[model samples]
Target: MLSIRNLHASVDDTEILKGLSLEVGDGEVHAIMGVNGSGKSTLGHVLAGRPGYTETEGSVQMDGQDLLALEPEIRSREGLFLAFQYPVEVPGVTNLEFLKAAVEARANHRGEEPPNASEFLKQARALCDAVNLDQAFLRRGVNEGFSGGEKKRNELMQMMLLQPKVAILDETDSGLDIDALQVVADGVNGLRAPDRSFVVITHYQRLLNFIEPDYVHVLVGGRIVRSGDKSLALELEEKGYRWLEDEVA
Candidate 1:
């Protein structure tokens, strides 16, 4: 459902994504593994249209629509979700309020009616349970006082509630403990459907143990170098990126 072709982007006059290309089919989860500076996070930022990552070349499309042409909010409304590597804090906005606004925005964009308060609360509470977050979190400021694991869980909570067609998770596995990791993974697994797809960006293969991706891609030098199945993750865990670099060289 998502296609990226030869995407080149730069930040602060330094090119990060050089000829990067990846295609994620509907319902397929793809894992991107690379060493530091390989542009795993840049691909996510560029796809989600975060400001400052200027696309110098190529194109990204979501189901035939020009993805890079749309504004960030429009991208989210168009069924593209990015779970940030470092979820930021919104001091005054409660988590419930933030999620409600996001839900309403997407609904309005899709020309659907917003959920009534009762329906919203019920669904929101269920999402909280799904991510193993306490109901109290719904009342707290968004990520303001949350620990690293809590922030990651909250990101998963957002992913579950939005139900985007294509979700890009940038290092969602980072800082998560084993239990929190499984909780996040369960949230992802529960949302799997024939019409949904996922791009899971992570540094370690441990995440693949819980949420097995349909394909595992090794990104290097700002582009994808190799695409393989789940077994590739295990191999990378054993051999490291140097093995792939040698092969490419």
Candidate 2:
């Protein structure tokens, strides 16, 4: 549902994503594996149109629309979601208030009516249970004072609520424990549908063990050097990026 071709992006005049290309079909999960500075996270940020991450060349299309032409909020309304590696805290905005606004904004974009406050809260509470978050957290500031795992779960919660057509998870497993990891994976798996796709950007194979991506790609020097089935992830785990680096070299 998303297509990226020869994408080149830079930050502060330093290029990060160099001639990167990827295609994600409906219902497919693609895992991007790479060491630090390999542009894994940069890919996600550029796709989501984060400020200062400039897309210098190439095209990104979401279901035939120019993804790069849209502003960040417009991109979200167009069904592109990016879950950050480090979720920032909004001290004064309560989680419930944030989620309600997001859901309402999406509804308005789609020309649909948003749920009533009570019903919305009910659904939010259920989602909190699903993500192992306490209902009380809905009253807390967005990700404020939340532990690392809790923040990740909060991201997942937002993803669930947004129901984006394409979700780019930027190292969502970085700080999660085994149990918390499983919860995040389960939440992702639960949202899998015939029309939805996910781009899971991660470093290790452990996250793959849970999300089970349909395709695993090795990114080196800001470009995807190899793509394969899940077994490729196992290979990377066993031998690390050195073998792949030599092959690419």
Candidate 3:
């Protein structure tokens, strides 16, 4: 469903991605693993059109559309979602309000009607239950005063509600305890479908244990240095990125 070719991006005048390329077909879940400074998160942010990250080369297509040519909102409207590694707190906006607006906008984009308040609330509460979040959280500000695990859960909630065609989760496993991790994984697994795809960016293979990616990729030096199936994750966990250093070089 998504194709990236020769993607070269930079931040603050320093190039961070060099000739990076990958393809994620419909119903595929691809896991990206690498050490710090290897551009795992950069690739996610670049795909989502994060501000100040300049793309000097390469093309990305969502389905058949020119993904990079659209504005960030347009990208969202076109069914691309990026779950942040660090979900920011917006103290004034209640979670319910934010989610309603987001859902409505996405609905409008697809020429569908927004759900009634009661129906929306019911769905939101059900998603909360699925993600193991308290129903009262809808009254709180976005990520405000939430613990680390709570923030990650909130991100997954957004992903579930948004229901994008291609979801890019940038280290959704970070800071989550075993219990929280399982809950979050369940949220992701529940949303799997034949028409959807996921790009899971993580540093460790532990996340894969829950989500079970269809493909695994090793990203190093701003490029993908290796690609394999789930067994690759286990191998990386055992051998470590040290062995890949020489291979990437």
Better by lDDT, candidate 2 or 1: 2
Q: What is the lDDT of residue 24 in candidate 1?
A: 90
lDDT tens string, model 1, 104-210?
Answer: 99999999999998899899999898788899999999999999999999998898889899999999999888998999998899899999999999999999999
Model 3 Cα shift for residue 132 (angstroms) = 0.8
lDDT of 3: 0.94
**Among all windows of ten consecutive residues in candidate 2, which has the lowest summed lDDT?**
42-51
Local error of candidate 3 at residue 233 (angstroms):
0.8
Which one wins on lDDT? Answer: 2
Q: Any residue pairs clashing in model 1, and if so which?
A: 27-196
Ranking by TM-score: 2, 3, 1
- Write one digit per residue (lDDT tens) for candidate 3, span 13-114: 999999999999999999999999999999999989999999999999999999999999889988999999999999999999999999999899889999
TM-score of 2: 0.99
TM for every model, in the order presented, reads 0.98, 0.99, 0.98
**lDDT for model 2, on a 0 to 1 scale?**
0.96
